[model samples]
Target chain A: MEKKVLLGNEAIARGAYEAGCHVATAYPGTPSTEILETIARDYREIRSQWSPNEKVALEVAAGASVSGGRALAAMKHVGLNVAADPLFTFSYTGVNGGFVIVNADDPSAWSSQNEQDNRHLARAAKVPMIEPSNPQEAKDFTKLAFDLSEEFDRPVIVRITTRIAHSQGIVELGERQEVPVKPFVRNPQKFVMLPAHARPRHVFIEEQHKKLKEYSNRSPLNRIEWGNKKRGIITDSVAYQYVKETCPDDSVLKIGMVWPMPDDVIREFAAGVEKLYVVEELDPFIEDYVKALGIPCTGKEIIPICFELTPDIVDRALNGKIKGGAYPKYETNPVPPRPPALCAGCPHGFVFTVLKKLDLHVNGDIGCYTLAALPPYSAMHTQGCMGAGIGMHLGMEKAHGPEMARKSVAVIGDSTFVHSGITPLIDLVYNKGTGTVIIMDNRGTAMTGHQDHPGTGKTLSGEETHTLDLELLVKAIGVKRVVVTDPKNVEELERIVREEVAAPEPSVIISKRKCILIK
Target chain B: MKNVIFAGVGGQGVILASKILMEVAKNAGYDVKESEVHGMAQRGGSVDCNVRYGDRVYSPLIPREEADFIVSLEMLEVMRKLEYLAPGGRLIVNTEKVNPAPVQTGAMQYPPDLREWISKNVKNALFVDTSGMLKEVGTRKALNIVMLGILSRDLEFTREQWESAIKSLVKEKFLDMNIKAFNLGREYN
Candidate 1:
């Protein structure tokens, strides 16, 4: 085995290669974007591509899995929300070949809108979830995830927080195992999820969970460490690393396979110790499960569940004090904050400057353009999730009148426009409402490290492909007037926006400019 | 165990410096774990990296007041990460202030007498005057490599190891310039 210091995301990609995954797909979102990028760049064995959005990514991977090939779809926690439709049903219609989805969560909203706990989603869907503590487990557990998914014939979710996804450590690398793909047979009862077929498969899934729960109890993923019998701590994922370093003397159960609770193992460990505590981050997922098992465990009550846990924070929670005396760093002067800003030559800033001048209530979508909402150009007023701007603009127009459309405008990125913006734009047109939507056609997903989108005319692997025509597509949606212009020409953009908002019909302004950061 | 932080603005080459440090640490048979902020938070923001090295490192994150060294590429960045410096920890700073967006826009003023604050508060601080050195290098980006050179003095690593690490991580065309910057950084300490 070769030893190398690899990031947690790189380890997952390494595991994907070693497990002989056939298809890899994703929509770039940090702390998880590198997983698909690594596969596309280094591993030629796997056919990897970027889908328009998370839903398309999951569907692409799902298609590969049902056709008897191991597949992987990795995304941030919010991206999972986009793919939840497939995730729920894929549990009932189990996999012919192994399928794993890496849900990378951001605690403290580091690069996300919310630090949502996705382990609950795994429990809700009755799908088994695996989490790794470090780069080493990030590799091993990801390899194990594919096997567990195949064993239970279900799509597995490997949940990871930003800490685990971004941290780099020494990992012992192993060779790739070219596992043969299972043959697809004519079995609609198992593969197809119509109401008639899905009902019994639901029962089949319930029975499988019973067997999976039994396996969870005995699975090597969940291990118990015997230390002092006085204080017992139950934890999973990166939090397990903190618990181990903070309270080495305490008896602890490290839950690697996060879902199913590993009931028998949990009960066995709980019976061996006193003053049991569950240590986790963001949410009390394991704590809630342990309590429902009728086991008295203290969690979230004392241990704060706000952000990621460090060793000292874990010690302070577990032992009622810092490991060492906490030294107060500063006394009088407060350090000024250094917030992120758009690049010096950013095209988005120019458009937002015009909007600020026009005094339009801009509804901004996610991307580098979101920075326009900040100082120097406080143009954007309301902001929401991906593709939320267009619909919210429509809602405003509907409640108010055509005057509202003239007063306000919706702004979206090219990647997000395809992600979820199209349907909403169609909704605006079909409802006979007038709302001016600005599509910042940067030709790449700039916010998440410039990954290729459908509009970029390139696949995830850097292969040339058909570029989706944004202006034509909007016109086809029955948008009466569409104008394509450059934000660099600031005066004309201002004139165009003023003209479009005044028109009674729905109008689309495609501010086409290549991202400056992209070479 | 050694915990070092490279703090600077986003475009200041802090990430590349941290990577080179990790490479040097690994070359000296030390296990290294480096973690840095990415995504939306790092777009020309206060970017800092936590790099820990030892026989067997457990936590990639350094708790407050545990950093052995804090190498900064800009003047104000050192002040921002002062809390992470361990007692008697050595600080290597580039005595150059790249204005943050708010500062540049005149909403906030750049702290005056930053050098005075460093001298009064820090027991051992090496303020690297990269003005002339940056001129020779013909770019401000190589300042990170220069800061890395000063940091290399405090850590237990050989010159050959440093040279090899820089050579391996850096591009072929820019190797000579980065090596010159590294050597110029060593001339101070």
Candidate 2:
């Protein structure tokens, strides 16, 4: 076994590469973006790109898979929400090639607007959700996930958290395999899951699930470690490590395969131990499933139902309150609290600071500038999702009246502007609203590890794509009042914001600056 | 040999400090493993990095109350992660404060007298005037690098090894300025 240190995301990418994945598509989101980035950069055999959105990414990957190639699609937890429309139906229409949909979950909202646990999606879609505890498991589980996908003729959700996605660990490397591409078996009855085809597949899915549960029980990924069998804890992902650290002596069942929990194994383990505690990040999926089987197990009751788990949290729950549970005390100085902020030289900082000075009611989109909604630069008014800024600004003008609405504007980053912001700008021009859209063009997708966007003239594989110029794009959208300003020039930004805020009709302002990452 | 946990909001360069430490330890020929959180590309959010060095490394994970060095780039984040430092561990902090969105929105309370709060809870701590150092260095952007310089003295790596690692990290254009920043940081302690 050749072991080399690799990022968790890179390891997953490597695993897919070595597994002979042929096509991979993803929409850039935190934790998940690097999976595609690494594949595009290092794995020449896989065709990869950042699709327009999560739904499109999954659809494209599905198409590739249907063509009898191993394919994968990736997105953040929220991105899955956007792709849910396709995901639910895709379960009915199984895959010809091994297809894996990667959901990189942000449990503690570390870099997300909201902390969403995606295990619910797997359960709702009736798809198996597999989570890896570390970089090694991340790679191994990915390979297993594809095999399960092909075996069941279904899509598998490879769920990962912030820690597993970003952490670096020594992983054993493997030689890339060469898999011959199979021709797509275009049987209308089998390929197309119409109500007629879906009924049998639906029944087939239930049978598949029963077999999957048995497979989950038999799989080596789900194993029981015997230390002390008195107090049992069943955990998965990073939480397994925490449980081991906190209660190393306890009989622990560390699950590498997270979802479609093995009920028989859990019942046997729960019966053997005096008390069992289920440990998982964000949700009580296993605990609830175990309890539903009439097995009394403690999970979210003793552990927090929110956020990621740590040794401290586990120690407090397992021992501190119950004697012999207190972790070793560490004396620390009570340092002051400091929150994150935009860099002093960050162009977005200046632009938002100017917007606050102008007292413009700025509708914000997602990006590093989301910080502008906080602190001294409290400029952003409403923030929902990407591209909502321009459309929301127009809606505000219609609701707040044309005269007062002239003070309304939408502030967004250039990469964000391309992601979903362009449609709203087109909507504004067509609907005729007295609103201004400020595009903070920071050359790079700064928040998601400085990956390039369509506007940056770079593709996911670093190949040049057709660069979408915001200026020309806005003009083409039929916006007449388009002005590009340097965000670093706070004075100019303030003046421009004021001018556009008082304008009689819809306008576009492009605040162009190179990102700090690029610099 | 000690495990250091760097905690701060995203964009505070907490990860960079850990990365620099990893570089120093690697250059010093000590076994080291550094783990950092990725995927916070949207806003200023919680971020942490773990740097461990010793005779041999088993896992990249850090346990509760096990960190020998606790670097607090942000105040609340420091308190949030203080439980990770082992007894007698050193706490290095930047005195400057930036509040989170919730605090600014009045949805959360901003802790008052951060140093005192930390001193009350933690046994040993060092406060470096990082904001002042950054201003004196003539670049607020260099605050993270400056803190690394201060950490350099506390690190186990030799001065030459540290310098060479830092030198190889950046372009030549900023080398002189960064050297000045590092020296200024070293002098702060």
Candidate 3:
């Protein structure tokens, strides 16, 4: 075994590859983008792509799994929210081949906009969740996730945090194991999941969960170390490693598969240990779960239900010997707030600056332009999830006539526009809402570390592929007034926004700018 | 023999310099666990890296307040990572100033004469003309490595190890240039 330093995202991709992942799909979001990208780039046997959205990603992976190929669908924490509808039903329909959903959670919004705890979704969907602590575990758990998925005939969620996804560590590489493609056995009663078949499948899913939990009780993934009985800690993922490092004297039950918790194993563990404490990030998922079994525990109360936990933070929370204020303190500087800004030379910067100069009520969508909501460019008055700007702008135009709408424009990132901006653009065109939708085509997705989307003429793994032209996409949607302009030219960009805002019909303006990081 | 943490904002070259130090230590045959913050945090954010060196390195994680040398590339980053340094340990700081996320957010106040400010707050501090040093060398990107060159005076790695590391880190095409830059930095101090 050779030890090579690898990022956690790359490690997970390697693990998926070693486990014979035939198909992988994901939507680009930070902390998780590299997982699919690395798989697509490094693993020649594996087929991977950046799906249009998280929902489509899940459906595509699910379709691949039904064809009897091991598949993986990855997304950030919130992307799960978009994919949850299919995820909930997939648990009932089950999988013909192993299907693992990698949810890279940004616990502190380190690379994300939200710090959502995703274990709730795993529990809500009755799917098992595996949390890995470091790069090595990130790889191992991914392989194990696929195995568990096939064994239980259900999709497993391998939940990882931002720290674990970005952190680098030495991982022992493993050999890839291939699976023969199975024939499509058409069993409509099992595969279709119609209401009639779903009821039985739901019961089967419950039984499968119990069997999996029973298996977990004896599984090597979860372990108990004998030590001082008092101050017993129940932790998983990185928290387990922190507890081990900080409170080594205390006995601990380290859990990897947090959901469908091994009831018998935990019950025995709690009975043997005293003063049970739970250490977890974001939520009291494990603490609450163990307590539900009538075992008393302290969690979130002392461990904090927010942000990541370091060894120092864990030591202090556990009332250990770590000195007070020993950890890195948050910055305390009273300067003007510059929540990330568009670079000085950014092409999009000029366009937003001009839009603000024109005093246009710009509804902005996600991307680098979202930074326009801040400083010198404060052009965006409203910004939300992908494609919301167009919808919000259409609503504004419908409420207030064309003259009023003339002062408003919807600005969206080109990649985001393709992802969800089409529906709103169609609404504006068919329903006669008069407002300009600026598609900020920054070539690559600048915000989430410059991953390629539909418009970049590249695939998820930086391959040369057919790039979707935004102008053609807009024209196909029947938008009459579509224009492209270099965003660096502020005068031209502002003139276009003002002119399009006054146009009577739905219009689209593709503000062409190569992302600063990419270029 | 000791751990050092270099905390700074993105583009401050803290990561590159820390990597240079780690590489130097490794070339000197000392075990090293170097941890970095990759992906999102590197884009104009408060970024820091850890370098733990000894005969044996147990884990990649460095304990809080255990760092023997704190090399701060930006002022507020020093304030942010002050606890990492031992109370009586030396702080090598660049007099250069850059606002951190909190400062830019108007949530905190930027300290004045940041090097002196940290000296006032910390137990032992040394202020260095990193900006001037890099300018004298005719390259702004080498500021952190130059600061690290200044640090090599008190550290374990020999000048030869530092030179070897610079050779290893930079691309082959520019290796000779970076080695000259590193040698200039080593000679200045």
Candidate 4:
């Protein structure tokens, strides 16, 4: 076997391929984006596509699974919230050919709006969850997740953090093991979740949970490493690596399977050590569970509940120096702050520059276009998650009337508009509100890397596909006035935008341009 | 084990330079691990990577004050990561100054005595005027490779090995110019 250095996300993609995944679908989000990108670029055997949003991505993968093909969906931690509607019920329906969902979490909110721990979601959804400490485990656990999903007849969640997802480590490559796809059976009772069938399916999910809990107790994934018997650290995922590096002599209970956590195994490990510490990032999820089992353990009190934990932080926390602030201190001159900015020739720059000159109240959405909030082009006023711009613009229009609303405009990317912007755009027309919606169609999802979307005219595997016409779509949704203009024509763009916003009728301006970095 | 910190602004190729070092270390048959920041931060923001190599590496992160060498692509980014340098650690810094967003927006000023302050603090600081060297090469993008060339002087890898690493990493179109820039950096005082 040849060894290759790989990022944790790349390793997960490799694991999915080697596990014989038939289809992979995802929407690009930090840390998790590369998983699908790697699969799309490297693995031609698997049919991979980037969905409009996380919710649609999960549904697409679910459809593949129900049709008797192994499927995987990848997204960032916050993206899970968008996909939660399908995920909560998918647990009850199980799968026909195995399903795996990768949730890349951010502990310090690095490159994200929040550092949400998705392990709780896995527990709430009653799905098996695996956490990998390094790139090697990232690969192995992904393959294991698919197998476990099929074995337990449920979808498995693989939770990763920024440190694990982006860090590089050596991994041994393996040949692809293609699993024969099972025939898709038309069983309405199992697949369809009309309240009547869902009632029985919920009971089946409960039964599966019980069996999984039993399986977790003796599973090889959760192992106990012997060291100094006095102190034992119970941790999983990236936190486990920090523990090992910081306290090498301490006994470790590395829980690879994070959910339905090997209760008996944990109890046995606790009994042997005089002192136990549950080390995990963000929420004290494992710490809370261990305490629930009547196990005395030290956690958040000493470790500090916020931010990503480094090896030095962990060591100082355990040694009681953290409270005294006994960390490395250096004397140096003050450095200039380097905040992220829009690229030199970014098409969004023109729109933002125009918006600032016009002094328009711009409602922004997620993606690289969000950078407009910074620096010389501080054009964006309100940015509230993905797909919120259109609705926020409509709400402001209805509350303040057309005179004030004419000064406000919603700015969103092409992919984001395809994601959740459609419903809100329709709302603008149905509610009889007059607000200008500027779809900054960069021709691709520029943020989290240029992954293909419905509007890109290409699939994730680089195959030419049907491209959505933003102008036609907006007009079809009952927006009487819709105009398409190139962002490069700054003079024309500013003139048209001014005219549309003051029209006293709902309108859309599709500012068309390709991302400078895409080519 | 040796810990190296490569620090610079986003577009300086700091990550790529560290990655090249990682590959060179791996080729030398030493266990290696590295960490880098990606995604939103890559847009002209301060970026750094930790590259550790030796018999074994448990953590990708280098502990505070544990870095054996600090390779800085920009002067200010060097100050930001000064805490990562071990006492008596070697510092190979490019004297190129990049005005960050605040300074460019006139909200902040670049510290005037940065070079004097670095000289007063560090004992083994080797400062090279990378911008001047790149002027000879006729391309500013080769600044990272030039800095790597200066750092290679203290490492155990042969000259051929360093050149081979550069050859593998740099694009074919710009290979000869980068090779020349690396050599010029190596010969600089």
The top-ranked prediction according to TM-score is 1
Q: A10-95, model 1: which lDDT tens digit per residue?
A: 99999999999999999999889999988988888989988888988999998899989999999999999999999999889889
Q: Give the TM-score (vs. native) of candidate 1.
A: 0.97
lDDT of each: 0.87, 0.79, 0.79, 0.88
Give the DockQ (C-alpha) for candidate 2. 0.23
Per residue, candidate 4 scores C-alpha lDDT tens digits across A113-200 of: 7787899999999889999998989999999999999999899999999888999887889999989888899989999999999999
Docking class of 1: medium
True lDDT of residue A160, candidate 4: 92
* Regions more than 4 Å wrong, model 4: A321-334, B135-138, B163-188
Query: How big is the positional error of residue B25 in model 1, measured in Å on the Cα after superposition?
Result: 2.5
Interface RMSD after interface superposition, each candidate: 2.7, 5.6, 4.4, 3.3
Please give the lDDT score at residue A153 for candidate 4: 88
Candidate 4: residue A171 lDDT (0-100):
86
Q: Which residue pairs come into collision in candidate 1? A: none
lDDT tens string, model 1, B5-62?
Answer: 9999887888788888888888778888888778865588898989999887777788
Name the lDDT value of residue B44 in candidate 4. Answer: 80
Per-prediction DockQ, in order?
Answer: 0.55, 0.23, 0.31, 0.55
lDDT of 2 by residue, B104-181 (tens): 656666667667766766668888777777777788777777877877777666767767767877679887777778
Cα shift from native, residue B158, model 3 (Å): 6.6
Candidate 4 CA-lDDT value: 0.88
> For candidate 2, what is the recovered fraction of reference interface contacts?
0.29
